[model samples]
Target: MSTSDPYVDLRSRAFAIAYQMLGSVGEAEDVMQEAFLRLHRTQRDGETIASPRAYIATLVTRLAIDQWRSARARREQYVGEWLPEPLAADPSPGEHAETADSLSLAVLVLLETLTPQQRAAFLLREVFDYPYTEVAEIIGTDVDTTRHLVARARRRVRERRPRYHATRQQQRRLAGRFFAAVEHGDLPALEELLAQDVAMHGDGGGRVPALGRPLNGRQPVARVLAAMAPLLARAGGVRFDLTKVNGQPGALVFDTRGLLVAVMALDITDGHIQTIHSIVNPDKLQHFGRVGNLGDLVRADPDPTGDA
Candidate 1:
């Protein structure tokens, strides 16, 4: 790679690496900005860096690790479950240079369980294709140790990662079915699509009332969905626009006014809905564009007379 293109061509690549490491668009962007400042300072100070791309990657990686540590603390005290801010990802086919191969909403949630160093090591080596030697230097460890960290991280993640038994189209079909079931309050239908031990998570961040703990099991999860479904029409009208939430089949919910409301992503395992990741946190949603008040799901009835 040419030195000059590092500033322009590698911009998106930098964001991809940071996003994979930090899992927050806002924070990743911030890391990139800080990295730009550092690069400028180095250049202005008459420093001669051999490779701008590697230098920027190193800067972003270290910064991201710091951000992850800081954010992890706040997340521990977050009002409710904390989910990575969702993004509408562009279509990526084949082994694209920017492919965060296993990066998804659910996978990121799993990544959260890995120690920051382990996560950093795994991402640097596995996702970004950084050589083990470079990965070690980036995370400040020996090459052999970095290899072990990546191996251990991979093992831990594999133990928790979903088998991905369903194709994108199949997953989308299931998502559509589940959304429809919720919209119409079809409890039986909801149950049919959910895995026996399906899990549901909601992130309202206390700005809105949301379940703090995950709801597990098909029956309980289904019941909650049936109850929450009314929140849709209660908004008078809402749009469930199909979107790829973190590279998975998901939707961008909008109220009647065309404002983004909730961003939902699903994990489908064995052809059944296994997990639902819902982000209603206004703070998080603010970066998600626009959304309506989820608290209003109770007041407005989708159909008061029970005619529909």
Candidate 2:
């Protein structure tokens, strides 16, 4: 790869599209590598490329759609709730609000409801600001068909997307208060930070114990957290570090040995926590660093004396 090659500069943009389309960093990276390889081969064969950007984007979109189709069956058989692999950083923060929101774990989860072609069209048109004609070219559909795909996807997303959006500063502050309440086992404070219909989702991939279904309602969610606070403390060597996950206020949990054990992303709205997404599946945490055996943490012995 030459430093002067435009592909070098387009890597990040290409990654943003691939990641959003596939919702898996590893898979998106694989798509990028393959796309670049093809590009290199074509150039080496003395082919004249008019627009490297559009050409690469088309390659990435098509490749990601294929990957998504193949992965569908595996995801269908996955144990427990399924969540997109959490992204540790925002790909492009200066982009428009729609692009930023599209990166959220919440939105990505909702995007799973659409067909692969619909998802590609929607992301290209709505999030990346691609025109319908270009989106049609990328997805290999007629312009009218592409418009229909985008409209249908937009409708589906609108029905499920978060109604309220929070600023980064607000998310950090609320997340701090929410986590503090959890750490201290303050039931009232925890409940105060959550909305009336708040929900908590956990994805353990059947390797560790997790909520088989989303736990809903503020009181139920708060009670569970309060009960787990002492258990987590008793587990010993557990640490929680505040950080960003999927462009939202979240935390990275580590064991005594400093291995990542889990990730938690919060969805805040109207100055309250609306949803909590927790990923404890070891397979998903490998990208972060070494992963600890979460089962050990979850299996910690409780106080035998009727006090716990």
Candidate 3:
């Protein structure tokens, strides 16, 4: 929107590229700014960019891959389960509706299983529809290698991804029921709503009270939820807002004080909750405004009332 900025026109695409690669809003915005700086310097130095879009795209892709690789080590050593930062909704880019399939929390988590080159290759070719030749050029690999990277990454994602992603309406009904059972401490009803092998993943990021490991099976998960129901009744009880999270049907958790306390995303299959991702990291809630610290809630309640 700034005519004074030379890279203004390419900003959206640059953001899209960086976001898809880094899977973090803060880092994506930062990488895009770096891309713009480089673009400005190049043009200011009397260099004519024959294809500014490609040039910027390539720049952002490379930068994001570098950051992602470096961050991978830190991520692996992170205290608890790591979930991608949740975005409330897709941001608009003028009139064109930007596709957000790859930007979802689910897909981004799957992308983490990939190597940086594989992620870059797959996103460029599969998600962005870039040509193999161009993807290779951008990734600094051969065309065949780029094609192989995309193929390998795609296969792993397909195999690990949920069999079905329920409709938003279905998700709303399901989430409503899931938490209702929790509020009522009805373990049987809640367990029935989940798949037999359902697994719940909580990401407290070692900064909050969360399940230290993935809880597997319906019975165990249900029992834990039932036990925590009372604690969730703090203040005015936990309120659930059926909202879009990273382009998927998810819910935001707010305490009685109207502060966002958690981000909950469910992967549904066959009308059943397959996986529940509970993100309670305060660091991941900056977008939700000033949220109360998890420590405060733990100290105050210290009771059983948790949600994912």
Candidate 4:
């Protein structure tokens, strides 16, 4: 509300841009504040900038890109698995409401595989609807180059996407069945629900002895479930509460103390789970604050006795 700055409009735009790029509220705030500080410092020094809004956006994008690179290295060294922290509410709906219709946790996780430039381009163009010329300016690349980047990025993402769509109610019902299988160690039921070519990718960051690579095929996925049985057994019990991630149905796992320990997201196609993504790395979990009262998802407590 301060009128001291002539570029007030630019500040608001910068914040929206940062939030969309980082997808973390805390991180977005940091980027926005830093960009503004830089702007103030430049003005104080009597430096002139053309299009302050664009300049601020460029700075924020650069910062986000750098963070993405550093995060990639850390994720590479992470423990058991890497899952994008489930948002208490969908971050995508605000800025990315349109493309968000098809958003999935599995897809966001796949985004981690893209380079920072590609990620920025895809988000700017697909999510923000930025034109190619503007996208090029923000990314510091030519328009042709930007176009190619977006195309390639989209193609790669499409290749990894599974074919599936289910109503929220149906999803909830299937999720219940999924947890039941895991709780009882019912491999047959698990296999039945999983696609024949099921793929499970755990981002353990090489910290925990996890399935470092994508586990493909029904047999391999089944083996993964088998391997985790002992761990789940040792934990005594687990509870799957529904939550939102990138605006899609996600599962939040908590321990007896109600402290969140892990989150799982699935990609279902034709009533079958094609992909199961589990995020257990504590560092990643930090971004996702406590799963606020999920109401009925918690009330049902399919395995409340901790013996499911």
- What clash count goes with each model? 2, 0, 4, 7
Q: Write the per-residue lDDT of candidate 4 for residues 41-128, one digit (tens) a residue.
A: 9989999987776778788998888776676777676554556555545553245444553345666667777888998898778866
| Candidate 2 local distance difference test against the native | 0.86
Top lDDT hit: 2
Across residues 47-91, which tens digit of lDDT does each residue of candidate 1 receive? 998988889888998999899899888888988677788787643
Query: What lDDT tens digits, residue by residue, belong to model 2 across residues 5-48?
Result: 55666888788888888878899999999999998999999999
Order of all candidates by TM-score, from best down to worst? 2, 1, 3, 4
Q: How far is candidate 3 from the true structure (C-alpha RMSD, Å)?
A: 3.3
TM-score of each: 0.89, 0.93, 0.87, 0.73
Clashing pairs in 4: 78-205, 79-207, 79-208, 80-204, 81-203, 81-204, 82-203
Better of 3 and 4 by TM-score: 3
Model 4: number of backbone collisions: 7
Arranged by lDDT with the best first, the candidates are: 2, 1, 3, 4
> Which residue pairs clash within candidate 1?
260-290, 260-291
* Residue pair clashes in candidate 3: 228-304, 228-305, 231-304, 232-305
State which candidate has the highest TM-score. Answer: 2
Question: lDDT scores for all predictions?
Answer: 0.79, 0.86, 0.79, 0.68
Tell me the lDDT of candidate 3.
Answer: 0.79
lDDT of 4: 0.68
Candidate 1 — number of clashing residue pairs? Answer: 2
